[model samples]
Target: MNKVSMRFLMSMMLIVGGYAFAKAQSAQSLLKEVDSKVKSYKNIAIDFKYALSNEAQGVNQETKGNVVLKGDLYALNLLGTKQIFDGASIYTIVPEDEEVTISAVSDQDENAITPSKMLSFFNDGYIQKMDITQKVNGRTIQYVKLTPMDSNSEVKHTLLGIDTTTKHIYRLIIVQKNDTKITITVNSFKANQPMSANAFVFDESKYADYYINKI
Candidate 1:
């Protein structure tokens, strides 16, 4: 090619490369801001709608749940079950089965996104890229696409949507390798509210009739 054509090609490449770099930097910066905001809160309470669907399998389910988080502790209630993580152990209480299973938090899968880690799971083990933005309920939702770095991970990709005005997570969409999609949309988010002393504590005595299994 002539010198003029070569110069134009180089200029175009540089422009494209620079734009890509800036986009990545912007995404990382936004995520950092979100993390900082979350850390600033003493605690968080969230009510969300959960949906799981697989068109190929003809499976669809929807439910609602709520969770309260403080530091490494969290209390989650969903689908007639309540799970409490008390910084060290996890207690899963099933009302239908009338059973309570206790297990150490260390025994849980490291890659599993537990209730306590839902907001901050993207801090590692994933590649973050800025995705599309949309207006939801008069609020701006910015989506970040996360691709798992582990090739063997069951998750195909995840989209985390943050409300730009509040820097709070608005929605999470996870697509599994088996083509199942799970979506969680935040209906309400409250931070720094007064919590009861026993909010994160499990009272085994109250479940005297239920069988307790410790693992």
Candidate 2:
């Protein structure tokens, strides 16, 4: 090829590379801003819709849940169960079975994304890239795709949608290796609300009729 043609091709490559790098940097900065805003809140309460689907397996489920988080503590209600993490131990209450299981936080799965870590789990173990931006219900939602660094992880990738104006998370979509997809969409989000003194505490006396199993 001619020298002029070669130079032009190289220039084009450089331009494309530069744009890709800038896009990556922008995604990182946006995530950092989201993390900062989440940490600044004293506490957060969220109501969300949950969905799980696997087309190949013909499995589909949908539910609604709510969680209240403060520091490392969180109370979550989902799938007909209530789980409370009080920084030290986790108490899971199942009304249908009339059972309550108590276990130490250290005994829980290390990779499991608990309610307390839901918003900030992307801070580690992931490669972030800016994705598409869409208009949803008159709100601009910017998406960021995260690929897990762990090769053995069941998750294939995750798409996090952030509200551009509020800088708050709007939705999370997790696609697994087995083609199972889990999506969580935030319906309501509130921060720094007045919480009861025992919001994270487990009151065993109230559940006298239920069987308590401590692990």
Report the alpha-carbon TM-score of model 2 versus the true structure.
Answer: 0.98
- Runs of candidate 1 with Cα error greater than 4 angstroms are none
TM-score of 1: 0.98
C-alpha positional error of residue 113 in candidate 1 after TM-score superposition, expressed in Å: 0.9
Residue-wise C-alpha lDDT for candidate 2, range 49-135, written one tens digit per residue = 999999999999999999999988999999999999988999999999999999998898887778988999999999999999999
Put down candidate 1 lDDT per residue, 1-215, tens digits, no spaces: 99999999999999999998888888888888889999999999999999999999999999999999998899999999999988889999999999999999889999998898899998998998899999998999999999999999999999999999899999999999999999999999999999999998999999999999999
Error of 2 at 177 (Å): 0.4
Residue pairs of candidate 1 with colliding backbone atoms: none
Q: How many collisions between residues are there in candidate 1?
A: 0
Lowest lDDT sum, 10 consecutive residues, model 1, at: 23-32
Q: What is the C-alpha lDDT of each candidate?
A: 0.94, 0.95
Q: What is the lDDT of residue 127 in candidate 2?
A: 94
TM-score versus the correct structure, for each prediction: 0.98, 0.98
